[model samples]
Target: MPMAADIFDRARAASRDLEGVTRPAWSSEDQAAADILLGAAQEHGLTTRMDAIGNTYARLAGRDETAPGILSGSHLDSVARGGNFDGLAGAVAAVTALAAIRRAGMVPGCNLTAMGTRCEESVWFGIAYVGARLAVGNMDRAEFDALVRLDSGRSIADHMTDQGLAVDDIWRADGPEIKPANTKAFLELHIEQGPLLMEQDAPLGIATAVRGNLRYGDGVCYGAYQHSAATPRRLRQDTVLAVTELLQRLEALWHEIEDGVDPSAVFTIGKLFTDPANHALTKVPGECHFSLNFGSTEQRSQDRFAAAIAAMTEEIGRRRRVRFVLGDPVGSSPTPLDPGLRAGLLASAQSLAIPATEFATVGHDASIFARAGIPAAVLLVRNDDGSHNPHEKMDLGDFEQGVQVLAATMLDLAAE
Candidate 1:
């Protein structure tokens, strides 16, 4: 059986030509990455198949074929120019661990499936967990119609058609669904994607929950345009000023929430820009655009965020005499990890003497499963340089430790 390092090496080599591990949803590069996983599964003598939505699964049958299976793996899709280990590491870990079990000639009590999901990154279609939702039959036509590619302005249905997927079956729920009835539990092995593990000098961590996030993708601020030299500072409705003040107010709100309400609450302004065609160096800007991303483990914190933003917008609009429009924020609520799976992972780590901590600030496909009432857990490998960057660093030793724990946990679960 190939070790975890070998599995990661093969994945990196296969995707080397793709832009910094970018394999966007329904893109050919994404298919190529999936093909690598398929080939590896086939080589290991596991039964491989692709679903209508393009999710591939490699199954190692258990003593009882009718029993619900343990599903493990993460997305194969990546954000443009993203790091290699962000989503791919989990899939590789699943494959490696399954192969190790096979090599040991240990037959699990229940079916074990290694999956490679598609389109977990929301950057492609403005919707997260597309593949996982589809696999579990959580996607509806209305939600499917709402998914439009940010770059091409094309519907998700178009992308599926382009990829030769059976869109009708996907939409009408014409096939088998990976629900709790047939899925005993879901597990993912992913990189920490932050510096917490490195700071604590640990190689692994077990996630406690996935943070709920609100994203305002098309927030806009409007003000009347005027000559920069002619408009008085107080009289002019400057959009730049309005936006700056709004941001400051939001930052203040962040402090208030975190310090007093919920320390886990976090917020960021990822994108802000003005239309180049409508403005000049001398003209006071008429409009500006920005994005707001805030997340918290507590649902009540999200409610407070909405109230604060509305109050701030009303105040700023009145004082500055400008219109403030925020796009409809779309997001998911926080999902806690399954206690049994989390405890199993912790025990496995402890038995191996691998130091680990608890994390709850990131989102993953595992969260989608958790929200659907399926038992789910995430094991994070310590990584440096953070994630979603070309320079992201994940040490081989750290990755191996995570894989070890994942394998042991799966074995223990299967025996139960």
Candidate 2:
């Protein structure tokens, strides 16, 4: 456990930004964190390799080399100025567990690989699970080329090239490098990004499902600018008011869904702003830009929310005399974790006398694997301050407990 703590500290220092850690996908900071993990794996006598998309893997050879392997770990990238344990904790826990297994001199029936995935944070490319998607062949070549890094405004391919990855080889591959046929199961251990675990007073959680989302990143409302003082309320076309009305309607819809349909439904407007260059205190605002996100654990809920958004936007736009241009929506269907795998994780925790609970989780790379027909599970460690911020607070003891459960589950599956 000291080794785990040491690796966490080193990763935090390596990726340290202004206040928290920042490891953009395929950036030097991300590579540095991977190096630290791979170094630990090597030190413990494990073999290491990198895929075309820069997903780092440290493998402990099994008794049967040809059999499907058990894959563990999580992404190494972080949101800008985000907490250290959001993604990195999972990777560390994996390598540390493997190290502990090796130190015990126990070789299982199949390989145990600790993976460090790249670009899991959507803040970088406005998409999640880029590395996992490429590894699993879920992403098309065109989608790969179309994605641009938000901050640098460069293509994902450009960023991969800068990191010395084989972009052409990745695009030319017939299938994903990590396939369901060859992978026994995938497990990811990440800190709970919300206050649920803390509120439950539990040190760990076994995920039931990953919430699917509908997101609009470039939604806009346009209206003609007018004199604020002279324009009458009925004559002026106000975009700000129109957007707020849409948001209010969306919130009301969410409340309805939460109360009557799906209790897991949630909505947020993370970003909203008026055009600063053209707007004035005396002039009526002409344009508004915003981001809208809706999530639910049920596909029917997602469909209902999407339908409501279309209807509400039309009515609000017509009444306010503004045009609403909601750019292409992006999202995925809700992914349910493998019931057998979930049971195994829960049994492991129970056997270890670790009091834990099961709950739904936000999106993670585990969803990618599950959708690819590879059984997957997620172990959530408690974090008090939540995630994607500077104040994440995951106790080392809780992390060790999670790792203990992860190692036990891997061992059980590998023996089979």
Each model's TM-score, in the order given? 0.87, 0.88
- Cα deviation of 264 in candidate 2 (Å)? 2.0
Candidate 2 C-alpha lDDT tens digits along 146-168: 99999999999999999998898
lDDT of 2: 0.91
Which stretch of 10 consecutive residues in model 2 shows the poorest summed lDDT?
A: 171-180
| Tens-digit lDDT string for candidate 1 (196-271) | 9989999999988888988888999999888999988889888888888989988888888899757767899999
Per-residue error for 382 in candidate 2, Å, reads: 0.8
After superposition, candidate 1 runs with Cα above 4 Å error:
1-3, 141-176, 223-242, 272-289
